[model samples]
Target: MKKFFTSLQTKLVISFLLLILVITGGTFLITNTQSKKALLDSTRDDMLQTVALVSTQFTAADLQTLSGFKAGDDGSPAYLSMIRRLRDMRSLSPNMVNFYIMSIAGNNISFVVDDAVSGPALVGDVYTDPDPRLFDAVAAPSVSDNFYTDAWGTFISAYAPLKDANGNTAFVVGGDMDASQVITRQNFIGTTIYYIMAGAILFAGFMIAIFSVTIIKDIKKLDKTADEISKGNTKVSVDVHRSDEIGDLADSFGRMVASLKIMMDMDEQPGDK
Candidate 1:
């Protein structure tokens, strides 16, 4: 086991594998973080802008009517108008889930009107689970810093204040959109990193195997030539063909063989005399 680990082939392969892993892992982490931030920032900005524009189309009277929060209020012109606008706004993009109005009463936030017809929450219902940002949004436009989940699955939301006759914030216009695409993109990136790491390991292993084998074969040739020359046979050639360090060593070995043959021949001529 110790010899196996100490072998040149094993050392070369292990060292290269570690280097590749570090490089690939670092690159993947950076790409993942940057991609998420870019996607989130771009999406959040768009959502905030869209909701902010929608707020301008309505007046204080339009907002005040939705406050009645009764079954009768649901039939009012302002309520119907809000629902129609919510659906129309949502229709602008397939990824849009819903558009709604949430009333801010002090620090408490609740639903007043929603484009969604069913079950997550309905008109006049206070959010049992709310993102704290909703309270801050009462003052101005704001967006979720990241994806959040509730009964409606995952979404990135934005809110903009709707002003009253006195120019005070009367309500908040909110938007919800699908987050699956971004999540899927991140997942795809993660999978791609695994594939890259695997490919790097395999490629490095193959190259290291070839490199170590070539070096060892050249060194063995020199060793064999040395042994034969020590037994008075200097005719054998060193047959290594490389342009690297191994080739230089082979050239040196070949010169030593030629010098040995000359010395042996000179000695033989003196004996012949």
Candidate 2:
């Protein structure tokens, strides 16, 4: 086996196989990344469009209409009612985890959860100045925005600026879905491709090993003949009949042994006669 590996032809075959595997692995990784990115981007767009439609029902102008609402009140009836409305809209989409309406000036967060697992601990939380990055990016433009953050445990969030009838940005509307959703899908795909490629490599290696063994056995015969000739036995002949390079090598070795045998015979005949 070691001798076979030392052969130039065997080394070339091994290198070619390795190169193929490297190229295939890189292509798989690139394909996985592109597919995952496209899926996440499409989901983000759909979520933002849903938020826009739902916002139509709960406009910035309607904030004043929500009665009995105080600026600093927590769990107030008006606030709870708005949260319930937000939760109802989110229930329509399984992918939507939670949505929040944040007051730009007061910095109060009013959130609604489709499920208790979604945002139970953050329903009526108030931050003095909630994560300035979120405020700056989410509230700057009226256009929908997307961002990723680990502050709230790795979430992919989309924000849309809300404008009242007076054409002023009152609060920022934001929604968060888990980032791991996309990654999970990618992992599954990668695992599947890995198994498939591994199987292919194993099959190809088995075939190559079988053929290499046959070639190596023939070469070993040639080595045996050379050992015999070196020990003063020059009558042994190689029986290789193939047209390959290994066969040509064996034929040349056989011809050299025949020539040596003739010379030995001529020297012995002179002494006997």
Candidate 3:
């Protein structure tokens, strides 16, 4: 076993195999990380686009519709019908969990929820715990902001404030859409593909190194050495028998033995150390 390990063929095979393993492992890690980043980036872009589309639908004219229902001056079946219609519009988008319109002037908010757990019961409630940024957005008459919450399966919550016909910040029309599944699935697929490719490359490299070093190269060297030995040189130097280091050492020992034999045959005196 020790001799086998010291042979050039064995050393070459081991070194090649180790190199292949490292390269393959590194490739897998890099691909995996890149894939994850790409997927998340894609999800973020999609969410952004969706939010922009939803916000665009909230205009000054739309705020007028909500304002009528908020003030008792326009309390009628038509106003109720309009609110229901707005809620229906919010529900039309499958990605959206809920849509809300907040009245910054009245400090009142109304919401329509598609998620059963966080449904419309929370609608028509006032927000006393006001965020200054949120208020500013509603005041801007077209303020858009993005928010995230892990509680509702990690959604990108967005709001775009709209002004009334009088150019006053009257309301914000915004919605929350779930991103957990979309983002998570992307991550999973990217990770899986990265690992698969990595494993395949590692396996292929290992096979190539093993076959080339231990089998192909070693066999060629062995055949060359055999031909040299067959030339019938007695007291052959093992070094000249092959091009490997092992062959060189063996040849040196062979030459030494040959010299010793010739000296003994000559009846040399034992004065030589």
Candidate 4:
């Protein structure tokens, strides 16, 4: 076992493996990073477009009615209608986890209508410490740059304003997607990269092993033939059959052996030939 590990073949195999690891690992990392960014950017655009499309379904009057209600009024007919409408709209896009409206008043953002369908937030509930991006959304459609943390944990989101009759911003409609979706996909990309890396290393090791063994085996044969010649044996032949450097060395050694036999014949006396 020790002899095998210390052999030239093993050393060459290890060297090639290291090179393959560095090159394949670098490319895998770069690809993983780019794939993650592209997935997030694409998801952000899709979510933004989702919220934008959903915003068009609501008029300012729908939000205007719900904007005045308090916590206990969450079960009101108008609010329930809004909830049903939001849920129906949400069903069309399963990736969208939730849809709601937040009325923007200076720095104060309050929930007007949210269709969570479970433990829903009440009307007129103030959003605690809202992200400043929500305010920007009141002017134009805007989305979070990536998955971001809020009172509800991390999620990718987009927001667009619902316009009133006077063309003023009534409320900002928002859409949400679970952060786990992005995480799951990123994990997938990393996993794929690792698989490819493993396969690449194995292939490199296999090829290097074949090459190293071929050269070493030929050299060993040459060494054995030389030892036989040193002991005065001239009938043994250098039997290597390759076209590479080792083949050339074998050819040269064979010629030397042949010339030695010719010289030995010439040196013989008539009776000693």
**Quick one: best TM-score, which candidate?**
4
Which 10 successive residues of model 1 have the least lDDT summed? 66-75
Judge candidate 1 against the unseen true structure and give its global Cα lDDT, from 0 to 1.
Answer: 0.78
lDDT of 1 by residue, 1-273 (tens): 239888766787788778877887787788767876886788788888888888888865677676666634666776777788778877875566888888888867778887786663566777766766777777889888888887777888888898888878878888887789767766776677668767877887788778877887788788888888899886787788889988998898888888888888789788764
Candidate 3 backbone overlaps, count: 4
Candidate 2 lDDT for residue 262: 84
lDDT of each: 0.78, 0.63, 0.55, 0.83
Best by lDDT: 4
Off by over 4 Å in 1: 75-78, 192-209, 227-235, 261-273
Summarize candidate 4's per-residue lDDT along 12-96 as a digit string, tens digits: 7788878888998899889989988998899888988888998888766676675676777788887788889999989998988
State how far residue 195 of model 1 sits from its true place (Å): 4.2
Rank ordering of all candidates by lDDT, starting from the highest: 4, 1, 2, 3
Candidates 1 and 4: which is better by TM-score?
4
TM-score of each candidate?
0.84, 0.67, 0.55, 0.88
Lowest summed-lDDT stretch of 10 residues in model 4? 264-273
TM-score winner between 2 and 4, please give it.
Answer: 4
Instruction: Please identify model 4 stretches exceeding 4 Å from their true place.
Output: 1-7, 264-273
